[model samples]
Target: MQNLTPQTILKEKFGYDNFRTGQLDVIEKVLAHKHALAIMPTGGGKSITYQLPAMLFDGITLVISPLISLMKDQVDGLDAMGIDATFLNSTLSGQVQAQRMSDLRSGYYKMLYVSPERLEISSFFDFIQQLPIELVAIDEAHVMSQWGHDFRPSYLNILPLLAKIPGNPAVLGLTATATDRVRQNLQQLLGVADEDTILTGFARDNLALKIAHNVDKRQYVQEYLRENKDQSGIIYAATRKQVDELYEFLNKKGVKAGHYHAGLPERERQAMQEAFLFDEVQVMVATNAFGMGINKPNVRFVIHYSVPGNIEAYYQEIGRAGRDGLPAEAVLLYAPQDIHLQEFFVQKSEGTEEHKQNEYNKIREMNAFANTQSCLPRYLLGYFGEIVDHDCGHCSNCLDSREMVDVTTDSQRVLANVVRMNQSFGKAMVAKVLKGSQDATVKKYDYLMKLPTYGLMKDRTLKDLSSFIDYLTADGYLRIEGGEFPVLKVTEIGARVLKGQLVVEKRVNRRVIAQQKVTSAAKGLKLSESDNKLFAELKSKRLELAREAGIPPFLIFSDKTLMNMAILRPQTDEEFLAISGVGEKKFDIYHKEFADVIVKQH
Candidate 1:
């Protein structure tokens, strides 16, 4: 408890002589009891904001988190730092929970992670009141707002409970995403006084954000999975079904994907997260719940399967990568339908009518960006009111798009085909008619008799046509004539353009590359001369260790483990565990062998 200063903690435990950009300043203010709301970027050391003080303080620090897997991951990280940490939740049985409550009373843990609702229990409150509570940290505090992408009703109860605490514990609310509105809400509702809010602007210059098109996103991700091959990563999707589908697809494609979402059973979620942390699962397909407090420092890529709701949401999701200060890729695959995905959440919001109205307005603002003619990165940065120093030149809008051509003639043919088909056709069927493809609908229209622009538009793919149609809707050139999935109706603008009265263009459409065929660790890893020797030795030792532990060989170590062994050449048991893939099971078995090999100098 004596080393509360960020300086001492960083030097002593973490062996770091200095703090990164805003770390020292934020930690200093936090220790000085500033009720701070920090908007640090992803890869920023957000955890250290609370952790330094938690280590320096007298009583147990309680971290209120949204996800249980996050709790365990952070606990594991803190434990690695040699700090006492534990997580309490429904995952703990009544007996185990009772025992942990006793441990908390005995001050056995320096920090504890508990769900917001679990802490709301009267008995839990009584126990909490008994403890020497030092700090109350809220990870992902933006979620309390009804407008936040990952809102939780349980988070609302924290305000009242913090009020009742005998000691109004110094509060630290950390999130990677927060608008001026959400930030203001956290300040007022969470007792974070206006002056106390630390607005460390969200800007990570280290990350190269790119949006790629034409490649199948699944295939694109597969290529990323193959090329980066051994690096740690997470792929985010908007839906649980996407999470499940992407998880299976990635696995089928050969990436060891750990599918994680709130819908999974607690045990299953924990097991999958543990596998990821242990490096048994090289990639995770998850909703946002899989991140928040999970601290894996060397993650090299964060792929978004759909457009995240806003820049704040986008920054937080992508922030999970490049945390280790290495070059990392943040690939976002945004199809035209993605804007609707977040829009769905906006329309489904539950709160005061005023709150819902505010959320709806934000959703509309977000839509404007989705349909903007400016740089995509600039549009994202502009949302947070930050001016981009230069056009990033890395986003899809910059790389994938060409100048939109006057597709008036193309639109005429598309519209004519739709009109000829009684306006009953989807965009795909209509597109085929323009390309002169004699498919079911094109033949049904056998209206090849009227192949307007047929074969003239063969260069355009369905995706290209979709993008044109999408922008037409956004640009007020055309409207979906019906409800969701409506047939297109050329608008007054479209008619004007068709008649050559007006001229316009939009960004050319692009497609996401699906990940390439999944290649396995054994398939892609060609061990160098030294690496092959190290792998053989590591594998032999691992097999022996697994037999002794009576577990599967892979249960002891993975290909990633052997790979790390070849790269790091650790000289001690302590150092061996510090390598990314070496977990408890492996360390227990192959530590001496790996260390002996590292020291062998062969």
Candidate 2:
């Protein structure tokens, strides 16, 4: 544990020559025995921050993880790298737990991953006091914040557990997605200072963010899978029924796929996870419960079968794909009506009124994101408080070649109606009044018919008017007051638009276009026929080696690594080592097998 820097640990153990952004800084903070709060996107190398420190520290690092699958995946990955790591969770038998506890007492492990609930046992706290724990790393730290998208009441126990420990150990809180408020909450709860919170940009340039509105999602997904058959991907539905239906549809269509949801038995879920991780299945259809702790790096696409609960959940879910810094697609199939499902969930969620209101606000933002005409990446980044001067140039909005039409007249009509209603109504009421609805609610206020703005937009459908209201609200022209039933009110900007002081423009989806097909490999890496053949051969070899070694294929070699091998045609051990991801350890294990493939091709 002495004289070991993060750089050497990364190279010798993890087979990487350089650290991704924000990793080294977090590692340095941990090494210096300082508390750190790191907000890195998924696949941004968060585990390495504390893992490297664990290697360099004289005592063990205790990781507070939320999910058993996540803990197992991390521990398995570390064990594969020749690092000593173990997880204690409900999955272990009593005997196994006792053995792990005994090992902890004897100082036999460098890292231990556990759930926060485990800390509630006073005896376990006593056991921890005996261990020389140098650091306590909290993964998915956002869950500790009740304001976060994913809130777990159990996570609140972490601070109490740390308090019981003998000495104040360095604390590292990590999450893939956290807003300024959530970050502040974590900082306060973990006792980390503002300066110690490190946030890398949330933008993932390699992910092509697209929102496909008003399309036959099933057909679109089928076509996408057919186009990218050789690649691995995940399709996330919002319910167990949808997961089953999608899984059945794909299976009937002859796609090698599997389904996962909470409804499935524990064994079945684990099998499905292992199947997907081992590349035995090319596509996974699952609910939101399926992917929190998965570490598969070669997923080429992630299609949201339905809109997620919030932007934070959406970003974190899509972050699962393209972990290897390769081009990937995150296509969200959105329908305006689909929002009802989320609203229903929010209403049914176990939380206070304020929590529900916060969730509703987040859902509104997510809905705006789906319908935004601006660059998807820019909108998402802005939501997370990151300002980008330019369009991401890769998302659906930026890539869309459609023309934006001036909707000032329509905007004025909507804003004027809100004013006529005295700004005390909701979006539905405004839309209904504008569309000249004779419904009882609209008729209840007989004065509505007398208003000049009433029936002014009768020629427009209610759906279109509703969408416009949504746009106006999101564009800062209008605001929705929070409550059981929100009232749409005009902001200063809306007042200006109503007074003809400002103009508005929005993208109109004139007609739906076919989704663009991207390659399975990294974008822009076109290989010739011979090179393609060599690439396939190398991939087959890599998969075979992965199976023989009982590990995930990406662990053996990422798709990027295999592509480099095919392109570089590295024929010797030394030549292979020059390729990225091929360090001395990997070279010692895989060079002969992969190099022979290249040499034979030559």
Per-residue lDDT for 80-120 in model 1, tens only?
Answer: 88989898887678999888878888888889898898887
TM-score per prediction, in order, is 0.66, 0.84
Candidate no. 1 TM-score: 0.66
Model 1 RMSD, rounded to 1 decimal: 20.4
Q: Write the per-residue lDDT of candidate 2 for residues 1-602, one digit (tens) a residue.
A: 57777888999999999999999888889988898999999999898999989998888999988888668878989999998999888899999999998898787899999888988777877788899999999989999998899999889966877877776789999999998889888888988887898999898999999989889999999999989999999999999999999999999999999999999999999999999999999999999898886889999999999999899999999999999889999999998767889988888878789899998888888887887778888889998899999998888889887757678988998888999999989999999999999999999999997899889887677887888788887777888887568899899988888788888988763321111111222345577888889999999998898899899999988888778677667644445665667778988888888878888999
C-alpha lDDT values of all predictions: 0.72, 0.87
In candidate 2, what residue range of length 10 has the lowest lDDT sum? 511-520
